[model samples]
Target: MIEQRDVVIIGGGHNGLTAAAYLAQAGLDVQVLERLDVLGGAAISAEAFAGVDARLSRYSYLVSLLPQRIIDDLGLSIELAPRRYSSYTPVPGGDTGLLVDNHDPMATAESFGALDAEDDVVAWAQFYEGTQHLARALFPTVTDPLLTRSEARAAVGDDRLWDALIEQPVGRTIADTFSNDLVRGVVYTDALIGTFAPNDDATLLANRCFLYHVIGGGTGDWNVPVGGMGAVSGELERAARLAGATLTTGAEVVALTTEKTVRWVDATGVEHETSAEHVLVNCSPHELARLLAAGDAGPASTADGAAAPPAEGAQVKVNLLLSRLPRLRDERVDPAAAFGGTFHINETFSQLQRAYDEAAAGQVPGVIPAEIYCHSLTDPSILGPELRASGAHTLTVFALHVPDRLLTEANNEAMRATLQRAVLDSLNSVLAEPIESLLLTDANGQPCVETKTTRDLEHVLRLPGGSIFHGDLAWPWAEDDEPLDTPARRWGVDTGMPGVLLCGSGARRGGAVSGIAGHNAAMAVLESR
Candidate 1:
């Protein structure tokens, strides 16, 4: 029997759930299909340590881009804890570090003075002042229909700021704004997160990535989800289910036709087909191309056209449970405070450039630019009472400039080990001692340390090329000459097809923990009706 519905969403990731919730709540006959047995895709929280009680956000950690509108509209009950400390980057081979405390401007200024970049205290403030302007003028437009490039620029109200951040390479502005290499790197890292771009890339891809990181919620502060990332997705799942969406897990969607027909196999190996008036795909564009069989559903490339380059993620994620927070080499700063916020190591501007060059040359960064943050310090609820009582802490390391091209199917295993060692050595450069020495053992008599490469993320999470944003991020606004006639184009969720729309990270405003893509897709579907 060929069942039919008003809408069918492929993939049960957080984005799919968001779309299902909105469409079903609007009274559409909505059905969602997921390949995994569980919901939450990359946003899941799980007990990473076997027989241990700490639940880690296995893939994506932290939240920034999720807007207040979605939470309020869906009535999601997720709690986000903002850190008082913004970040702390230790000077390589030095006993001092720069700590940005949100609550104490004097203290932060003093830290900058200690680094002898007393001039930057003012430059730092001015730089972020521009970002806040970008945030206020641009953030609200995300939920609304797409705006033209000229409109978005006029909204910023600063021709100089818009020209610097939007028109030019991000590295040029960073160089002009900050004289200190470390401080410039701190600002530059935002551009490189999940993207493999350089300081002077003319494509302005890094500029797009930088805007999303800072414009989130108009404040740009990345917060810790009180109960790990799963709470975010769990609440989303509940909201979707309550909204009358038919959410099915283990229903592997193998094929999607140009006619909006979805074919899937259930857990018991039963095949089923469903057709819908509209289809929402929440997977990577590459995977979408395969499902559509390169059909005339627009280009299946990542974010660009059919000629878009293959997607590749740049970073290595490591999850570790330490018996206690490791001591910092900078005795002036408390280990709690350093680990509480983003802890930077070997991520100086010079280091990052060198790392990018090395990774481009098919090698690991000799001193990998990485960041570490302890979620338990912000919220201990993810750990069991016993584990909390034992003072165990969770440390997640995100090492940058490590691209997907570094790995092959044959060398994945060997490369993972090499990547882990490089990460450990890089992290140890900032610590007083080795982090492995502080690892807690699981019940299986193994150290509680796990490293994830792009290949592993592909195998485990099904992230195409393990690209977190699914592909290169497109501008949130359309060009003045472009047509916004269709509902899909109007919302920036169009997949270049008549019926199938992108409701995942592949969308224009998609990426991070943001539901903008899913929300936009739902609005597009509603507009079409």
Candidate 2:
């Protein structure tokens, strides 16, 4: 039997749900098919340790990309609490470290004053002011019509800002702006959040990642979700379902045709065929191309011998439910204040370069650069009352520059163990006590810490090469003369196919939890009508 709908969404990630909600609200019949039984994809929370009351956000830790407009438009019940501290980086064996207090500028200035960077306080504000200007100009247009590179540059209205952000290497921009190595690393960390680019490299990839990270709501504060990362996708799922959209999980879409015919197998091994007026894809572009190749659809168009950017994901994620917060080595800052925000370890500008170089040479760095955030400190709603009363906290560590190639099927387990130990050792280097001492034991007598490598992300989340951004994030403007006269083509929602639209991170202006791709895809469908 054949089912027909106005729109068929291939994956049920938050972006897919965002598209479904918008289209269904527009009175279009929309159906979302997800291969997994559960939704949210990487933005999910689970009890990793058996018999633990902690609901840890397994992947995709923080939130910065989701816009306020999406919440107001969708009427979502989600609440994002701002982090009191922006970041705290401890200097190993030093008396003090750098701390950027969100509420107090004097404290921030005082922190910088220690580095003899009192001038950086003013420079920091000026630097972010420039990014704020760029955000104001560009973020609003993400869901609207796409702009040409020249048009975007004109919109920016600053030649120097354009030259640094768009034209020149971000490394050059950073070196020119900041004098202190620690402060430089703090700013540069945004550039290499998911990217594997080295600090001295002259690539725009780091610039693009940096732009998206700080462009969040124009403030760039990565607010903590009340319930976890799951809350973001959960709200999106609720919005889509409430808008009269049909959501079907455990239905793997295997093939697609130019006519919008989708073939999938159900959980019960039953095959189903469905046709739609439009098909919105919520996976990577490479995956989309593979699906198209499986059917009557032709080969994906290439540019300069690249169908999609080389997909190599770096970073190792470790989730831990701690019995208590680890004591800080720095006596001035309390444990709560240190881990309340992003706690950086061994991530100096030069250290980041060393880690990248070592990872590029097929070995994890000796002293890995990683950041940790304790979720329970900001929002304890994700934990049970029993766990909360016991002072149990959740920590998510993001280790940078660990290449996926270092992890293979044969050594996946051993590599995860090694990386976990490395991450802990790096953290313990700054902490007064080893993090292992504070780990809560599960029912099976296993430590609460669970680590996920690139291999896990590929096998579990279906992220090709485990790339968090789906692929190298694209600059927010059109690259070629591929006809931006129409809304679909202009916004990069249209896949140059008859009825296919991209609504995932592969789309332009897409990365993190931003709903711009999904919103733009729906707008393309709506405007074309």
Best by lDDT: 1
Output the TM-score of candidate 1.
Answer: 0.98
Highest-TM-score candidate? 1
lDDT tens digits, residue span 46-134, model 2: 88899988888888878887877888889989888899998999876676788889899899899888777787789888998888888
Candidate 2 matches the true fold with a TM-score of 0.96
Worst 10 residues of 1 by lDDT: 298-307
Pairs that collide in candidate 1 are none
Q: lDDT of each structure?
A: 0.90, 0.85
lDDT computed for candidate 2? 0.85
> Per-residue CA lDDT of candidate 1, range 201-294, in tens?
7999999999999999888889999999999999999999999999999998888877889999999999999999999999877778777774
Show model 2 residue runs off by greater than 4 Å: 301-310, 479-482
For model 2, name the residue pairs that clash: none
| TM agreement with the true structure for every prediction | 0.98, 0.96
CA error at residue 381 for candidate 1, angstroms: 0.4
Which 10 successive residues of model 2 have the least lDDT summed? Answer: 301-310
